[model samples]
Target: MNRQAQAAVMFLLGAALLHAGATDLYLRYVKAGLQPLLLASGAVLIAAALATAWYERKRTRAAKAASASASASGTGAGHTHPEPRISWLLLLPLLSLILIAPPALGSYSALRAGTALQKPYALGTLPAGDPVPLSVVDYASRAAYGQGRSLHGRSVRVTGFLALDRTGTPYLVRMALNCCAADAQPVKIALAGKLPPVLQPDAWLEVTGTYSPKATHDPVNGGPIPYLSVTSAKPVPTPHDPYDETWNN
Candidate 1:
């Protein structure tokens, strides 16, 4: 290929890698840890493409000089050489993308949503016996803040997968993360009333309940035990975009 063609091929390949890397970073890290690396890689690739173009231009100039000298000497300049082709270089980025497509975050990570994390205090008193629409993320965040302490033992409703524990009860429920599973926290809630008729892991449900603070008693460490209490449990459907229960973006 001529200098222009070679430069074009390299530029395209670099651009492809940059795009693939960026997509993977976003999907896997959710704009958390992978963003800096993605940006740096993109900058490097652009610089490399520019450098390649400059080098190709110099090579073309030298080739032209040789051709002109041969013609001036009345030599057989009719002997034509096929241009070099570097189109294969474009495959580099394509191969990288195929090899490293980040896997979707799945059910495995949802189990780790709330353990060891301090539940949130309620911002204010919850309405008693009144149905309130709530997001799983909001619920989880509030629980983390203080388990709705401000709600003053009022009932609240939350929807998510019925992550049943080994005891066959809806004790430790969870939601999956699309990217990082390691950070998943199990949402622990005390089932106040009777257990659901069909308790199954990964089954979706909405639970309505009153907030009750359980006394803390920690055996593993000297620190005080975390309060664990809630009431009025009811089942509901899994929300749309189940993977991202938080809906915070």
Candidate 2:
């Protein structure tokens, strides 16, 4: 195919990938680190298309002029014209991406995982209130402040997969990661209230209650840590590519 046509196809594909990466559906369902790569690739494809188009146009113009002049001189009538060099267009996209580096996934993703924010917690049984979803970051941040002492008695809903302990009850849960599953930290929560009937590994759940601090020694980190006391619990489906909790990109 001609350089112009090839470039056009590449540009279209690049645009489509870029659009998908920018959307929430792709961010949620697709891999987390892929968005930036897509964006970078798209930019490169676009640049390549533009360069190819320009080069082809110039070559065509030059070829046409040469043909016209040769035909006028009656010396090019039996001569065959050589194909234009279009390979240089291939470097356009690559050069564009190299020039403008895309941003990499960073701590913002972890913070968005819901472990960074501080929330108020209630003492004893939590009073009936509206349900609010709390992320791991939120629970962790509040617990970091020494639990219920600082929360001032507020209820929150937490959701994640059920990570069962040896006792069959899900005492700890973790957010699955596609890129860094091993680094997944357990969202420490206390399930003292009504617990779910059947605990499924990696089963999603929505828990609502005031943050009542529980004295639990961290087994992994080897330290004393606070856990959220769940008031209500229900099963939920695990999200596709659940690792990317934040849609900052």
Global lDDT of each candidate:
0.51, 0.56
> What residue runs in model 1 are displaced by over 4 Å at the alpha carbon?
1-116, 119-129, 136-148, 172-184, 190-195, 214-249
| TM-score, cand. 2 vs. native | 0.53
Candidate 1 lDDT over 36-106, as tens digits, reads: 66667666767777888898788879978988998899876555677645655666665665466544433
**Candidate 2 residue-wise lDDT, 1-249, digit = tens:** 566777777777677557656764444334577678767877887888888889999998998898899989887545556555575566566455434433323322322243212233522333466564556545555565544543556778777555544555344344434443334334445456677666665556787777665656444454333566777778776654455333111
TM-score of each: 0.47, 0.53
Candidate 1 C-alpha error for residue 110, in Å: 4.7
TM-score of 1: 0.47
lDDT of 2 at 173: 46
Q: In candidate 1, residue 146 scores what lDDT?
A: 54
